[model samples]
Target: MDNQKRTMNTDAVISIRDLRISFGEYHVLRGVDLDLYQGENLVVLGRSGTGKSVLIKILVGLLKADAGTISAFGQRVDTMSKKELDDLRLKIGFSFQNSALYDSMTVRENLEFPLVRNARNLSRGDIDRAVEEALENVGLSQTINQMPSELSGGQRKRIGIARTLILKPDVMLYDEPTAGLDPITCIDINNLINEVKERYNTSSIVITHDLTCAKAVGDRVAMLFDGQFQRVGTFDEVFDTDDERVQQFYHYNFVE
Candidate 1:
């Protein structure tokens, strides 16, 4: 439960302080503070609409924060220009909840998209090698030519991860990685997440409501509620908390 025991490195890869966001009049994240260290998986545990997705979007520079500072790898994210943010994104991999693979593209093409867009200087051989390595990392090299439509939900998710891996990101963001999969497939994806982290030595933020995924992938868990992180610690530490709001999340009593 102790953060010192949970984290492998004291170096913070991502630092967010008093982060706040809103949509017109409805506030989403009020004032959230979080620090993700190198080589650690920090799980954000929150009910639906608690701004878990928004926080990561801000981290990746996809969304603008109305207040507070976001620092990634010691660079100020809030002030980064579009070009600078694009370069930053190359080091941060995001696996979306819906898999977000190109339905029309084959597995290989989906994996090649990032390289083609960002790694423009890579030779044909280099791109091919990158794709092969990423697929092998996800245990899907044999499915290289298969279309997204041909794969199962879990396989599609793996492909999404492979696509992210092709870029060799330093930080990984998984948004509901196991959502919509069967229990068995969920477990498979969970294991794959662990494998990727160990293989790449990447720091990550896994946003999910599934406690099983949290316990399996998280070095520390933070419960997001009422536009802020109410509590943060190891899975058991947060699970055992007496805070009523955290207990509501623990018991699946989400506010509607």
Candidate 2:
């Protein structure tokens, strides 16, 4: 494979080069390179424990890479200070795999938390409007007064997305958006991922092992294997090859 396609380019909303991390003797990511272009959904495909989730954490400075270059919005994430990282993170929205909603807070309060804490000097009206708009975007406006426990699995996921959307981040990072959901719910989340890009014009990196989610949401796909991206292309392009590793992924396309 020619290296230029995966190498960092100026137009990429997020670019990573030679990203490597390890746990004592076990190297999780040997040397990973990826580029997320503007307004494009780049799916990072890998089996569980391949470090897909770790890569996402590294992007947001939740975890540090042993060695690599991570650039988001033209800023070097690996070199950023705490203040700088915090500033950069405000522009990136991360939707966790399990939809990490606060059980103690109502849907409205959960949505308001980020804005109230991050955005200053906002009157009660501003927060209320933002919360309402976000809930509406995810088609969960009616659940505003409800608790996280009261919502279904899919509804909670939508609310998670809504909370992220409320911040109006320029980039979205979704970690297994379709994990642990029914087929119909997965389709809805897939549709929502596409809808988000169109509606917000935000570039995204969706990390998942689910091939169905990849084909539906990814403008391009990159497969992480053996601690590196061994395949990078479209849904068909990546899996069309006869490589046993890639074929194995295609054969087990459904979410577990």
Candidate 3:
């Protein structure tokens, strides 16, 4: 896909400034600032325990920030009420690290669960259509009746994405989408991420340690170190920097 042509209307869908979060004196995020623009993928690269997951949790309002301002779609997330936050979450899709599909549910059932809960007003026919469309988006329409256990890692990841897509979210938050998958499967997942961006025209934040995944899916890349962004730029711009720390983190030699 031609990302240059796809890039239109540079508007910020999500913005964070001076964001600070701490857990019992241990600071996870310290004065972090980020902006996720519409129709673009912003990949955050960081080692484990650098608060990537915590950042997403705060964005979704799962965890409160100690200090900072977070605004999504022009509304202040930090100041929103529980009801408002819950309503806002519907517009955001979160793909967890493990795919997080319920083992007891079939693929169809899993896809339907979100619609049944969030889209209560939809008719049965609408719900079925939504499920089918979501599955077809991920190219998994045939696995409708299959259980989560019967699917491969890649398949489960696709189902997880389908479940998220069922809501037709305006923003997507992906936490380690390529984790625990084989290299080939990782590439497939990365391709799907790109496809989703083009198809939905949604803004996305992809948190990952995998550089290949970052390069494949991210329109812009941000590196998190010491509770702040060490650098932010296009993949090549950041990767080609002269900073030793950045080079060391990316395993400089391996990236080429």
Candidate 4:
């Protein structure tokens, strides 16, 4: 693509250039570059403790990169003021590695919390409509009154997804959406991720170790290893590549 065309086509939902992150002496990310385009689902795959979660934290401003440029929605995120960060956050939805629901609230209340806290201009009726829409989107319209303790693992994940959807964020970051679920629930969540993209035209970055889940949701995949992106390509290209480390990791985790 030409420079102008590339710029227009990119209009990237999130951009990271030369990103480097460290926790004291341990560097988690090293000069990584990535661009998430509008309405695309990009999965970052890596083994345990490979900085997948930290990458997402950097995008959302929960953790700062030691050195890098992070731009979200065309604004530089790394240097954003607190107000700007909060504004940016409101446009991005995050589903934590754990569901991170409040035990004190029922599913209905949990879904409404963001709308109540951040969407103060919305009327009571508008909030209710948004909550119902979010629940319906995640196939949880009937579980509105259920508390966190009353739900199954899969149900909690779905509820968390619903909460994320309530904001209708332009970009959604999912951290291990199906980590501990049953095989059937894992597939269900994967399908739900696809559905969310189709329904809302939302862009996403999924952090996952599940190769099956990765293939299900990703239009393209990038392997993160040794604090950098080892390789990135379409599922077919990356998975079927002849590189020894890529082949070895896939065979070790996926092939019996």
Please give, for residues 105-206, the per-residue lDDT of candidate 1 as tens digits. 999999999899997889999999999999998888999999999998899999999999888899999999988898899899999999989999999999
Q: Rate the local accuracy (lDDT) of all candidates.
A: 0.89, 0.91, 0.90, 0.89
Q: How far in Å is the alpha carbon of 182 misplaced in model 4?
A: 0.9
Best by TM-score: 2
Off by over 4 Å in 4: 1-10
TM-score of 2: 0.95
Q: In lDDT terms, which candidate is top?
A: 2
Q: Per-residue lDDT for 1-256 in model 4, tens only?
A: 2333224224687887778998989988987778899999999999888899999999998998999788888888999999999999888999987899999999989999988999889998999899998988888889999899999998998899889889889899999999999999999999999999999899999999988899899998999988988788888888777888788878876786
Off by over 4 Å in 1: 1-10, 253-256
User: Which candidate model has the greater lDDT, 3 or 4?
Assistant: 3
On TM-score, the stronger of 2 and 4 is 2
- Angstrom error of the Cα, residue 164, model 3: value is 0.5
- Per-residue lDDT of model 3, residues 27-124, tens digit only: 98998888888899999999999999999989999889999888899888999998999899999999988899999999999999988999889999
Better of 1 and 2 by lDDT: 2
Give the clashing pairs for model 1: none
* Ranking of models by lDDT: 2, 3, 1, 4
What TM-score, computed on C-alpha atoms, does each candidate reach?
0.92, 0.95, 0.93, 0.94
